[model samples]
Target: MNVSIIKYNAGNVQSVLFALERIGINAVVTDNIDKLQTADKVIFPGVGEASSAMKYLKEKKLDEVIINLKQPVLGICLGMQLMCRFSEEGETNCLGIFDNNVKLFSADLKNTKVPQIGWNTIYDLKTNLYKNIIENEYMYFVHSYFAEISENTIAKTNYGLEYSSSLQKNNFYATQFHPEKSSDAGQKILENFIKI
Candidate 1:
């Protein structure tokens, strides 16, 4: 499969590429519009601030390319947040493939951190993305903002409160967690996505 990883100023591209390699898939990292449009599967992974990421996408016209893709697209972390209608992180408007909005974890929540780092279980799974994956399986996460639970939420996770850990709408799928760094279950999720 011709898998392309969308390249931007964001972090985590190398790790995602390595993870795909572990699954025996070689993925190309590029900002080339034509190459991205022609890929069989596209992975949009990021670890960065929202407003800046959106600015880069807009400059490259990748925001338009992403929203119009006909092939299966997988977005991770900040990539997932960018797919939403809006994000509190940067008071930014996003790709709007999913109707929900992203918000920051409340500081008032006792004993909870803003950026919920480390492993967390994801439940209420849906779609082919979770094939052979169990309920409440642990996935690695490192983020302060989260997408709210909405009609498109395929999987949910609880840190400060229950929120969307994964979402799916037609050809697009996203994970708030870093499946690349989540170990075995994560690899299984990647394998499943490839099969889809």
Candidate 2:
């Protein structure tokens, strides 16, 4: 299958491409909207500031292309954050594919740390993305901002409090964690996404 890893100021694209390569899948990485929209599957992976990333997508008109994509589109980390309607990180408007606002961890949770790093178990799972996945299974995560628990929450994870870890709304599916970096369980999650 033809897979495209979106290229708009990348940080994790190489790792994601490497992950796909390990699974024997060749993926194209590009910012060209036509290629992105026509690909069999589009993987939106990011590891950078949200506002800057959105700026780049908007420049390429990918901001609109991404929302209109019909195939299963997966967003990882910052990519997932960008899929939300708005983000507190830069008080910026986002793609609005997920219909929620992204917020920074409250300063009150100082004990919990700002950018939540490392593995955390995800529970209250609700999507087929969890087909072979079990409840409270640990996955990789490295993010400071998070999508608040909302209607589309398909999974939950803890930082200072329970928050949305994965979201699903129509053709848009996203995860706050980086499955490519999560070892075996992570691979299974990506496999599930590929099948979807």
- Measured by lDDT, the strongest candidate is 1
Separately for all candidates shown, the number of backbone clashes (residues 3 or more apart, or on different chains) is 0, 0
What is the number of residue pairs that collide in model 1? Answer: 0
User: Candidate 1 at 178: error in angstroms?
Assistant: 0.6
**lDDT (tens digit, per residue) of candidate 1 on 86-135:** 99988999999999999999999878987789999999999999998999
Name the candidate that leads on TM-score. 1
lDDT score, candidate 2, position 96: 88
lDDT of 2 at 17: 92
TM-score of each: 0.99, 0.96
Give the Å error, residue 128, model 1: 1.0
Candidate 2, residue 143: lDDT: 85
Off by over 4 Å in 1: none
